[model samples]
Target: MKFIHIDKENSIAFYQQIMSSIEKAIKEKKLLRNDKLPSVNKICIEHKISRDTVLLAYEKLKKKGVVKSIRAKGYYVRTEDFNFDERYFLLFDELNIFKEDLLNSFLKGLAGKVQVDTFFHHFDPAMFSKLISDNMGNYSKYIILAANVEGVESSIARLPKNDVYIIDQMRNSLKIYSGIYQNFVENIYTAMESVLDLLQKYNRYILIFPGHKEPYDMVTGFEKFCREHGKNYSVIPDLKNFKLRKGQVFLIPNDRQLVETIEKCNHHHLVIGEDIGIISYNETPLKKVVQNGITTLSTDFSEMGKKLAQMVLKNERKLIENKCTLNLRKSL
Candidate 1:
């Protein structure tokens, strides 16, 4: 492998420059399929750059199906016939089963004309800022799941405003950007109202909301519902040290807490739906069978993903609220 000099004065990013160099080599028939690329350490030392810079470039190549990594051996050229219409930078907070559904829907809706590179920040504001800043001008589109993190507006503003689209939860500071988000406050309040009659059967409604992981607006919505309807409600951070009482309905967001709630109910020999009710946050295939179908208040993640793909395909700049539904199952 030839060592290309790292040009400090060039407008192009270091990783992108590396990517282009390799791509050019492949196109010119200089680098053939199954050719072993230089090791990350070799590239870093030769170019006087950090390991992460080389790794990022190589990772992008791998995502484009240009290279494949062999365990302990290093990366090898996978193919030279690389073709893609558009490249997308998808940034999510984390991946869950429901999120997997959303991602797959988005990919299917695009029909493989575009190549997507997905990354996760895990709700870290600093990491989110760094990822966005590092990949500033690489992709044609940037789809982000902003979650509820603060101090991200400035970082988001640094991107091409017209090319950015926010997904999942939307922050107020990022309102100017195109987004498909769940109206947490409204969704929860309205969902509760829809099941007002069933809720009246319970003695008290308890929302197990750990503010750090769960959205605060959900708390707001739950509070608003309880206040307007004059229902007895209490907000607890988690199910730690929680005791199950008969005729008490629980609203759980986290799956771990949901399991704990169900286990605790079983310990007390309390029957779900009749003795106590449960309303899970997001719906999944497992939720349909667990405890004989757990009721859920969930937004249409599939539709959200599809709409996001449409926005990217048509280059439409719009704010969309993906619809949410109350799935009343046996748990309710």
Candidate 2:
């Protein structure tokens, strides 16, 4: 490994400075294809920087196809020439099973003609702004999942309007942007209507909504459903210290809460689908087997990803609403 210099006083980010140094080496023929680079720990120790900084730099290099990593070994130069026809910046709130489906489908739809670098904000406003600002002008397109984050319109405004696409949840501030999103309010309200007959068996409807990580429209829809139907309902932050009783149907959005609710039911010796009911938000393969199949009202994530790909490929600017469906299983 060659000596790499990092300037701590410079305005450039530490990871970016490291990336620039490596790219400069490769361009100037100092680093060749198949050449092994210094280990992350070694770089961190030599430069007196955190391991995360070095790892971030290496990860970015790997994403750009300038390097590759071998299991139990280290990073190596993958190619001398670095060029991509269509580079994309994909930003998401977080990764889950349904989101993974969407991501895989989006990749499949691209057909190997595009390079996509994905990042997660995890619903942090500052991190969301930083990620967008850091990657501006570097990618051909930006696909963002603005999941209930406030004041992100300014960050998104920095990108080229024609090259940006929003996904998952769309806010009024982001209405000018073209993307695919779910109408959570309408979807939830309609889904409840579809299963109104089954819901009548329960005495009250309880929704476990930890608001920080969930869509507010879901709460609105739940409230609207109860109000219009004249059904007794209550919204709680979580299932913590809450007692589960018979004749109460629970609408759970987060999977962790769904599991907790099921366990609470079991602890009380209450049978699912009979004594207490459950309806989860997103559908996954595991959901089909958990508790003899948990019922779900979910949007078609795979379809959303495919539509997004189409919009990007054709340069179409349209606000498309992906469809949602209710899957009635034994849990309901």
Per lDDT, the best of the predicted structures is 2
lDDT of each: 0.87, 0.89
Off by over 4 Å in 2: 1-80
How many clashes (backbone N, Cα, C below 3 Å) per candidate?
Answer: 0, 0
Clashes by residue pair, model 1: none
Model 1 / residue 248 / CA error / Å: 1.4
| Residue range 123-146, candidate 2, lDDT tens digits | 999999999987775667899998
The TM-score obtained by model 2 is: 0.76
Model 1 compared with the native: what TM-score? 0.77
Superposition error at 169 for model 1 (Å): 0.6
Residue-wise lDDT of candidate 1 within 49-132, one digit each (tens)? 999999999877865778778878998888878898457899998998878889999999899999898999998999999999
| CA lDDT, candidate 1, residue 302 | 90
Q: Can you give the lDDT of residue 133 in candidate 1?
A: 80
Backbone-clash count (model 2): 0
